[model samples]
Target chain A: MADITQLEAFVTQVRRDIVRQVHKVNSGHPGGSLGCAEFLVALYQHVLQRKEGFNMDGNQEDIFFLSNGHISPVFYSVLARSGYFPVEELNTFRLLNSRLQGHPTTHEGLPGIRIASGSLGQGISVAIGAAAAKKLNNDNHIVYALCGDGELQEGQNWEAIMYGSGNKVDNLIVAVDLNGQQIDGSTDTVLPLGDVKGKFEAFGWDVVTIEQGNDIQAILEGMESAKTKTGQGKPICVLLQTVMGNGVDFMMHTHAWHGKAPNDEQLASALAQNPETLGDY
Target chain B: MKTYIDTGKKDTRSGFGAGLTELGKTNENVVALCADLTGSLKMDAFKANHPERFFQVGIAEANMMGMAAGLTIGGKIPFTGTFANFSTGRVYDQIRQSIAYSGKNVKICASHAGVTLGEDGATHQILEDLGLMKMLPGMTVINTCDYNQTKAATIAIADYDGPVYLRFGRPKVANFTPENGSFTIGKAVELQEGTDVTIIATGHLVWEALEACKTLQEKGISAGVINIHTIKPLDAAAILKSVAITGCVVTAEEHNYLGGLGESVSRILAENHPVPQEFVATQDTFGESGTPDQLMEKYGLNAAAIVKAATKVVARK
Candidate 1:
């Protein structure tokens, strides 16, 4: 197990990176990035059993796919800090000729990204394929994917959800960032995703809910528990209940900041809350 | 004149199935996926032999496309089978973002293309698939002529390292190509040589163009015939060389005139050498339910149409 204090500091530093990267470009989806800070930090720091270097074909490693790729700020920061690439490369988050695209893509030869996923609802299906490949190779490592709750509105997600359980893709675990917020408005106002847990359960998934998604200990514990549910006949779904903007006080609990960057004063105030846990990029 | 004999008659989709079965036995990295059309797509032989690699996606084309793109991550060569309409138009965005833009090695093998998908009407018959696929960057578009060529192209695309769109049809046409021939990408095959006019054809129209050549011979018109299997990365050198010898050209295909082989040939001719050209294709109209023979005649995509276009273009020359 990893130290809880170190994990918490990693999450704080990730939050700072998310805000700073988006603020520098003055364009990006920061709300979901902030919300997914703890989950991503815990995933890279404590959860996944990774190999030494980055290669396109992850033969036996625990591979991850970011289906909702708009939140690349958090994904890039976590990957760099976890030693996938140089930490200072975070300065080229969405710049010209940078490997870091606005969405996560493998086109630029990025080390961590295995697929291009900005169009939404594609990650789960891709994860299922990778999981199937793992089963074919007899590789016991698990395949993980993260998606947004609002992205479920795409009909493709339901098709993948139906396929995951029907085909018995047991080596896969899908986690939904159930922030209840989208670009339009609250999920309820825009399109109510009524009973998301029930929906997954009805689709024959072994479902679990992480009630405190923003907490480092809760996410780590929940992910550890979810890992044990694999190798069974059914796939697993972790409905992580997170705030749209989790760490910062002003950006939380709303959909307005879903794709907006903070201004000068707002950036200073947001950075003050998290402090500088591990030197800024 | 160089004469060719028809070995047999077989549906192009069966050739795809035969090639897939060969791949299943040879390449362990090759995997196949279908959208609940295993029997229609003739993938039963492969599925029966290797059930572990065969995935039945069950009527969800979008999911199948995404999964195929995903399978490429672990260095698996994925081949997705379905009708041309669902393979290209329905799940285009999935193919564009996940497969084409990402530069994954995926072979989108499509069957039941053009008006020859008889009785299914315009919805099932996709005439615009070539244009849609060729427009995307880094996409290799191939429309094979016959059964033997289709099988060879299917097996050949596996070794090529990029996304490919292999289009074929349902009806059993002429199988004249060699049984064990080498299928090279972006190379045109010259069937016969003449000096009056050039007759370039693709897909079902290649056989029709050959028949037109015979009739034009009787009328004292020596016509050149070329088989263009690969539409994109077109053999412009072969086209320009043939047209330079033969002053005029007649392009034929079982597709719309706006974005089929005819338009591609015209573009090459206009840039390099402007020549009088006539199109033997459907004139911007949707096809209705009819027999394959009747639809081919009604759409003016037969040997008679090709012969007429060749004679008219030669007259202008």
Candidate 2:
């Protein structure tokens, strides 16, 4: 295993990248990006059993899908920092003619992306399909997908959720970013997602809850347990209860910053809180 | 006029089934998915033959479309099957984002298209699927005329990499094309030579156009027939060549004239060789419950309709 301190440093760097990239464009979803920095960092830097280099057909290796692609800042930061592409390309996030689309897509031939998401709730179905393909190809690698809790309201998610467990899609893990917040207001005030874990369990999934979702150690440990639950004739669900904006003090525990980027002074303040762990893009 | 023989009659969906069954035996990477319409889509053969490769996503077309796109990532070709309505309109966003925009190599095989679906009425019939599919960038839209052509097109698409929409119907119609004939996407088939009028048709109307050609000959008019199997990336060269000789054209289809094959041909003629054209399609309307023949007749999508349209447009020239 690598050093935890170094991984934490990478997470801080990813946070800096997220806010800085959004601040430059003056438009993006920074709250969810900051909130999921550790999860994505832990996923790319440590967890995923990735093959060397990138190809659209990710054969013989673990593949990932980002369902909540509005938080693309963190996904792009982690992917670039992990050597999927040049780190300097993060500067082009959300810019026209750039591969880093506002949401993730494979149309521009972006490496490490198998499907286009951002319409929400579709990543689960796509991941389930990939998992079945791996089974067909006799590849023992697992498939992982992440979606926002608020995205669960899309109806198509339930269609896919029912499909995954009913067909015994056991070689997959779907995580929910349970920030309890959406664009308008908190999930409870907007539309309550009652008994999220219970709903998954009733739908024939193996549920794994991570209460300390922002901590690198907690995410790693929770994901490790989720991995162990795979290949057991049931699809796995990871409920990650993270603060909306975890790292920056002012951005936390509110729904206001979900899609709003930081202003000039707010960017400086957000960057100061995270500190410069590695070099900035 | 050159007479063509109907070897037999068969539903186009069976042709899809035959092609899929052959692909299941030939290509290991080919996989099939149906949203609770395995029997209706004539996919039972492939499902039974390749149970491991076939996915039965019950009653969820949107999920099936997304899954089909995902299946392509691991070098698998997924063919999603359902009615034309469910395939195109019900799950358009799923198809647009996951398959079309993402550029996945998935074949969307839609059966029971247009008024030929009959008795099921307007809710199940989708006369605008061709328009919807062709609008997407890089999507290959194909509407097969008969059983043999549909079978060939179905097998041919497995070899062509990219997104494709293959449309066919449920009723048993005239199987006129050669058995085991060569199928080429975007290539038009000119059925006869004429000097008076050209009858360009797609889907179930090609056979009707041939019938109209015989009738027009009896009326002392020479009408040529051209089969447009592939609508998008339309065979503009063939249409122009035929229109140049005939000087007037009648476009026929089991779809609305607004954005169907008629409009595509209109754009071509309006730009290249300007000619008088008449549309033998639904005039921006919906269909209702009836026999396949009754609906085709009521919607003016049959041989009589083609004859009148051909006679009228030929007069303009």
| Root-mean-square deviation of every model | 1.2, 0.9
Candidate 1 on A157-226: residue-level lDDT in tens? 9999999999999888999999999999999999999999999999999997999999888998899889
Of the true interface contacts, the fraction found in model 1 is: 0.63
Question: Each candidate's DockQ score against the native complex?
Answer: 0.75, 0.85
> Model 1, range B123-154, lDDT digits (tens) per residue?
99888888889889999999998989999999
> What TM-score does each of the candidates earn?
0.98, 0.99
What is the C-alpha lDDT profile of model 2 across A133-186, one tens digit per residue? 999999999999999999999999999999999999999999999999999999
lDDT of each: 0.92, 0.93
User: DockQ score for model 1, please?
Assistant: 0.75
lDDT of 1 at A79: 95
